[model samples]
Target: MKFKTIVVVNDFSFVNGGAGQVAISSAIGLLAKGYRVILFTAVGPVDENLAKQGIEVVCLNQYDILHDPNRMRAIIQGVWNVKAKVVFEKLLRTLNRTETIIHFHAWSKGLSSSLFSVTKKQGFKTVVTLHDFFLYCPNGGFYDYPHNKICTKNPLGLSCIFCNCDARGYIQKIWRCIRQVIQNKMLYQIDGTLFLSISDLSTSIFKKYYPNKKALLFRVNNPVALLPLFERIHVENNNAYLFVARLSLEKGIDLFCEAVSQLGLEGYVLGDGYLLDTYKKKYPMIKFIGWVTGVEKENYIKMAKAFIFPSKWYETFGLSVAEMQSCGIPCIVPDKNAAAEQIIDGETGFIFQIGSLESLKDKIVCMEKMKMEDLARMSQQAFEYSLRENYSMETHLENITKLYDSNF
Candidate 1:
């Protein structure tokens, strides 16, 4: 490997979210290939899996932007953390920029944009995975939370700045705008920039507004944990429609609840969030299982007649939908997002109008009307499609290695 030293930078040491999990897994996979790897994080206690693998991890014990105890300090650090800069600079001092690669999976939550400034000054070979829209959009989702629709306004423009699209509030929106300004300035100063987008839509959306045309953009697959099975899982006997994601407005959980309740169908929701309690009370008919993982989550997947992903926002990639598909579960997703790419409409599953309650309900009814043989056939198709995509850890490593080789 030309770039023998890979330092994976993220906000958390553990699998806190999608980006964090990717960061941790990517590092571990790289180490398995015998690359000299280091995991640098801004939040701790470290993930036990990393420690078990004997990977070098540098944890800068700090709170995430939202959870930091001192509100004043959190606000200041969110923009540029002096401590993060100093610590990261120290780490860079020992590395040879020619052979070292600084790959950023996440930062906004804890590490801040200070680390980007180090990359700029040091001129190390760098790559950034567009896991979320935080680098460009102020609130990160590119969706107007107040209006509950996708926001088309260019980020940092007058309309975008004043629209109050942030989930928190307008003031937080202002702070995000400020952070973007600083982050942009730091990014422009660096050269030979590489951005690995999770999906084509994500790359297209990012290219529309991003000022740096010289920045190299490439689409890459995120390695999903589940793999396709040899024999198809029995889907005919499954009783309930499944919704597995955080219970939030952007996730389109309400739409799922509404569609399921309207049709009087059995439904299961297997995740927790701010809206969990509210949704549980509002729709008592739907089973709301809070945050099941491992075998418990797997059992829910096995029991699902069909999986639903009605994301209101422009999700770069839908992880859960792919995971369920790998388990031979047919998935019904909206046509707008990348998850729809995995589904073959009525064959593998169904594709409803994105964010439309009535359209979602219609699809649920259509799926319920599907004959047992058709349902089982679709399950086989879904599993075959997901498995054939080959989004395993080994394939991801091969793709990432190719990406690195091409960049250099």
Candidate 2:
């Protein structure tokens, strides 16, 4: 079953972050199956790689509204004008109805929520992959601003004030609240919604918020095409620990820094973020290598004794943790969130209590005393687990195809 006129909507045309990369890869996979994919984004400077792969790119002119200084005014203009809806509808009109599927990935940046309504009204089957919490939360990740703490309450609840979660402004929050109300009304209009993680905890959260929606939900894990170069292998002696992710607050980088500083262990940071300058100054002992990609990322993972993931929020999935495990390096993740599902504590790596520096410090101290052979064994277990249960590109494609096929 070939979807000859498939449209993929996202924030960017190129694969940069995890969602961007997933979007590009999914398009490539679809193209390989002889599906004609039209990659749409609000902004472009299309990914050179996607162009090289022969995927068509479409940029919506409505993206400029996001750059406006008065964000609330811009959002008001965006919601009423339905610029994104018009653009998407115009494109859909050109395609044969039977051969098309509108697959939306991310819509927070510039694309207004009205696009979904327009598509549904046109009788087009739509599939929306839940890459993050943007559809339900104003801030996208359901993370509180400044503090970067996770909000557990249902976004639609009456008592749910948007103050802490609103990154734009009070007026913008009002705009978002109005937008979310519209989105909730249009929730059942979608043909399917795909979640990448299968944790029962996450499923329960989704169920609570979207109880009345009849949309089909499927658990399809993201695929890693290449075996990450850092797959755990037996190392005679390993001393450096690695942290590979955006150095953001919700990622618990501050907690990791504090714990490592207290433990006095030698560690390396392989990412860049807003907290870099502050953390660097505060902890002079730890090495910060900024951002890395390709072979450079692999080299860092290969050299690291273990990976540290101390995230305090409910991660939909931990790609870095899986990548590190693939490298044969054990991980020390917080017991909270999806890391608990990813890391087999004591067998593959250790799981410390969430947000507790003392728990993390104790785990680091315990790991520090382990024999090199024992560490290597744990790394082997991590590698075996990732290979057996995760890391398959085929699995992701098959699951996604099932969702698409089932709807048709």
Candidate 3:
């Protein structure tokens, strides 16, 4: 029952974020490994790489919930997406179920849980990549957005349902809760499905919410393309601390801003989000370079003293933290979530007390005052550790292919 075909499912065809990047990259890798691959997405002007690599793509050509102009339609489609269900079902019917694996990477942004019903009705084996906690938490991140902290309430329970946790408002929170209820129902209907976790911390957090006795889950490292050792960023000589993520509340942008401002140190933010204008007005001291990709983005990362990943929630895997470390630039992460797991604390990078500005400032000051010799040593260790543990595409492909084959 080895899988010969993989239908890679995500909300977007382009690399909109981490999940889309993983879905597209892995689909390409799977094709190179001789498996027939198809990209099934809800949003696109499809990425050129997929077509260039000869991978088949089936796109819905739609907008994600947040960006959709029609509010009512986005809300409805975010819950069930009848069109996606029908079209995806038509696609599945043409394939031999036993030979195809539905590798679902993301959905909450657009496609919704209806895709699950499609796979269930068609009797196809599926592997869900735990890119985030949307399968359990209503808002994807188990975060109290307004309060700017990690949430402990049981998801969808009375306490969880009553919390006004959505970034938009309480009404949106309730709507997302309704969406989660249907998604959970569709999730629990399938049996013998595999949940692919990207980090041990992500695996642990997921296990807490999904304690169903029948659930199957395991950790699989996300493939990080290690940078060439010769191309290492001379971060030890840099003076500015860097923060790269959506300028959102749960990401702890406020914490980064306050910490760097209070210390009067140079700080730079590399990404953009809805909070950009507000952050610019509030923290004029911190430089906010609007979202830039490719060479421009890498150039910003290269000028960093250290990456400040002050995520307030339990991250599934802070891909940027891993990328920074892999590039021989240490990251300063809070002592919570998967970002901390990527660092060797005090060696590769420092881990501050979660949500404590004082703790974060202490680490930043430590990094700021460190001798050049010590900082260089830390960079060297970060690069060496990445090579040993955080593997590249080849190893990632091998591990994933084994999972696909063995699951059958």
Candidate 4:
């Protein structure tokens, strides 16, 4: 393979998010393939794992929108960070434009759309992975936090602008709309730019927003990191249903707790968020394991009867769903979102009606009644599909490398 320098852009140098992990994994894969790779971010002290891979990281060491305590400054920077533009411009100028591909995984965390405009202004061909819906929706998820449901209002429309869907409040919603305006002004920046959408569901959701001009769009599945199947035995019986995502309202954490409480079933929440204390107080029986990774995460999934992926938002891809499937664990997800795409219903796992607590509880009741032989068959099917399909890191690397080669 001919050596080509690849610039991977994201909000964080640390692998704390789905988009950031994908960006880091891709950079590492490129480096192993003998390509020069650079991870460009607006936040942090970098992850030691990236440095160990010999990939160069350029971080502005700025605070992300979530971490920045200065509310006014964070809002302003979220719209357009002039500092990021200046720093990124300098980095772009140093790289060989002809052999370099600027691939953006995320920008909503801190690096705003100004980075896109700057990349285009510098006359470099760029690629953006639609990790979320920030390019179209103001809050990223079309989810209405206040209402606890998905919002149908068009992006920046009168209704969308008026409705307070932001988790913070209406004031934050207004600021987000302002950011959307700034983002729209530079939508042309991504014109003729390649888009690496993580799922067909994401492409369908944002298809209307892509520039009118022809732009290459590739459907690249998120690479799931998993322990080899041969390393352990699959669990044939488990008592509790597990929820492993961030314990946020959009993740349907409340719904899970409610259903678990109603059914008088054992429920284990393996992640933490703002609503953790509130939910724990309301549902004392439900167990909260806080945040966990590696073996701890895998063991939690393995010991569960079925993994519950009740995301209320239109997730681009559910990494946890895929990870659980890899471990021969069935996942019960909403029939909407990208997680539903991974399930085969009665084969791999099950699907419940979107935003319906009753439907989820009924599914759990049905699973509890399932025969051991039937459950084992479904678990085996889930594992085989995840391992054989494009979800594996090997397949992700191959697809990315081919995309890179095509651009060259």
Candidate 5:
């Protein structure tokens, strides 16, 4: 029953975003641990780093829902990807189910929940990481996109369906609801164990939906590679704050801009999205550096006074906050969601009331008034806290492997 190999499934082989990065990182870690790891993805050219690590990668060479040109086909595939089912069926036949664990990172983006039905029909034990609320909620963020508020209505309920929550419009909302039904059916057909990144919040929400008494749940925090102690403490802190995430509305980039403008403070954005050009034109004061990675992205964070995470949604886990903290950088997060959990208010960083520009500006103004020595103390505390609690790549590998071993 000991797992000798792990199959990590997601929608993309390339690191598209947080979920893809997590899946690829986990595969690389398994390879380093001398375990046979396979990266199974529906739409990808394949990540070179994973292939370089001597891990097997099977990419279907298709397009994700976002990239697919055919709208109808994309919508259908988003619900049920029959091609993925057939391909995975053949792959499942090759693996010894007892020695292999199929761990799914994401499916809603492209792969769809049809893969779960494949695993059940093939009689293989599987695990699913709650990367987002796609398995339970229609729009995947438990957010009412039209209203730009947190959604509390029950999924698929008449009230939920009656309300238009999709960012695209009412049509997309209906499509997402239909897709949710398909995902739910496939999810309930199998008894896969759950891996929750933020156990306190995500686990509870998931349990409310599924509530399978026999389901095994594990709290495995997403891994963040710790920077060296010298880099963590030695970075020169500038006067400006930094925001690093996709430049989207739900990400609260607009809110961050409004807060900075109110305080007459400088802010820098390090990621790109649909709203990049619009944000650039609307807020000429804030510098939008498009997107950055590796040392460049790290340097932006290191030079900033504080990392500002103003996401309006309830994040399952805020990986960027952990990364910033690991580098001895204080963070400003909303009082709600997982980002708040990463920082100790007024100590490691500050947490402001959600959706309040005055509260956000006040928090930033407070940080602006803090003395250099006080800031340094907070940064040191942030770094120490991250290293101790926020898991590293090594810790994550050990945790997931232990879960695999214990299950069987």
Candidate 6:
């Protein structure tokens, strides 16, 4: 039960949003429990925050592979890089075989699908956490290409054509298809797969395609770590709604902006994205605060009347929803996907019909009529509900340690 070394592989450094935060939190939790945790990432002049936390970060650039224009070359480097594979192998050889477990978060960006192939061939027990739909979908978001619409088509269907979901055109789609094939093959070698939310509708779609795999399935919803709650300072602002997610089409920000414009209400946006400039020009009244973190993020959550979560795709888990709930902020989310699991309609928060601008507008109008006391009560319920359902780092660490102990 005493694990001396634990290796976590992710796509990016931990200073970025949600996925990186998850990686850092889990690494910190494991380190606290006496594991020598090492993080393997593709590119990093290591994030100072992660370095300060005492976690060792290994970048893949130590390998002699130069960046390539061909997508296949990058994929090959991820799988067959002698230096990166040797670094991992050296760590494994130094540890007791029975006491080491490789926990992989993501391998999409730099580490190719073949990293899992190396781990499995070395006879190392491995676990992968599903962060997005990239494991099966070539686009990673289960969104149709060019149009940016939600795609419900089964990936294994013969009619499954690349939608060019990344907006990079036909060549990109072809490369993504190749990546998908590589990923599916590598997954067969993994010992277990963990989902952050139980409401993984896309994962269910994946199951129908590959029903014979013996991977152990575990759902440990992402933890919400927030600043300490303070006394409610109810600000009387009826027009103050908040949107705190990446400003992308799939996030339904376009619909949200249109709805707000129809309502003639001004709101605040707390993140930036590819659509930021476009939306800013279109809606001059709404405030864009461009990526607030820590105290700034905390205050924004506290000041908002209600947070809007208008995502169209099946999000793995709404990390922003959990963060809002922690700060006693109610959210108006769509009825489908993981948002349905997180929100208690008319109680903790409200649920609008998915992909309907009219329904979203109706919900916003309904919120305008609610008494401040009722909203306050709902906020309290939201905060309490989050504390009950979402795991804390301490609890998650204990659960994962138990899983490793019992399974290994």
lDDT of each: 0.88, 0.73, 0.87, 0.84, 0.83, 0.73
- Worst lDDT run of 10 residues, candidate 6, spans 230-239
Per-candidate RMSD, Å: 1.2, 2.5, 1.6, 1.7, 1.7, 2.9
- Model 6 agreement with the true structure over 73-95: per-residue lDDT tens digits: 66566444445566666666666
Q: In angstroms, how far off is 247's CA in candidate 5?
A: 0.9
- In model 3, the Cα lDDT at residue 119 comes to 87
Output the lDDT of residue 300, model 3: 79
The superposed Cα distance between candidate 6 and the true structure at residue 313, in angstroms, equals 1.0
Q: By TM-score, who's the top model here?
A: 1
Record all residue pairs in model 6 with backbone atoms less than 3 Å apart, i.e. clashing.
none
Model 2: per-residue Cα lDDT over 1-408, one tens digit each: 855677887877766577777888888888877889889787666788788889988876444457858766576655544666777788888888777888888766666667777777777767776667666765566666555677766675665554646655666667777777777677565555444334544565566666554546666777765544543455437677777778877888887888777877778898998889988998899999999888787776666788889887777677778777776778899875776788888989999987787988888887888887788788788888887885576678778777677657
Which lDDT tens digits does candidate 4 get at residues 1-408? 643888899999888878888888888988888888989899987999899999999898899987799988898899998898998999989977777888888888888988878777877778888888887899999889888888878888899998989988999899899998888788665556777888878888767764453667789887877655552235466787898888888898988999988989889999888888888899899999999977787667667888898899889989888878777888899987888888998899999998999999888888888898888888889888876775767788888778877865
For model 5, residues 44-112, the per-residue Cα lDDT tens digits are 788888767899988888899977999888988988898998998899899998888898999888888
lDDT of 1 by residue, 230-291 (tens): 55678878888999888898899999999999899999999999999899999999999999
Tell me model 1's lDDT, rounded to 2 decimals.
Answer: 0.88
TM-score of 6: 0.90
Clashing pairs in 1: none
TM-score list, all predictions: 0.98, 0.91, 0.96, 0.95, 0.96, 0.90
User: Which ranges in model 1 have alpha carbons more than 4 Å from their true place?
Assistant: 227-230
Rank by lDDT, highest first. 1, 3, 4, 5, 2, 6
lDDT of 3 by residue, 1-408 (tens): 288899999999899888887899989999998899999999988999999999999999988988999999998999989889989999999999979999999988889999998888888998999998897889888898788888889999999999998888999999999998898889889888998899887888777788585577867888865444445678778888889889887788989999999999898998888899999999998999988777787777778888899988888888888778777888899876888888888999999988888999999899888899899889888877776784687888888788878866
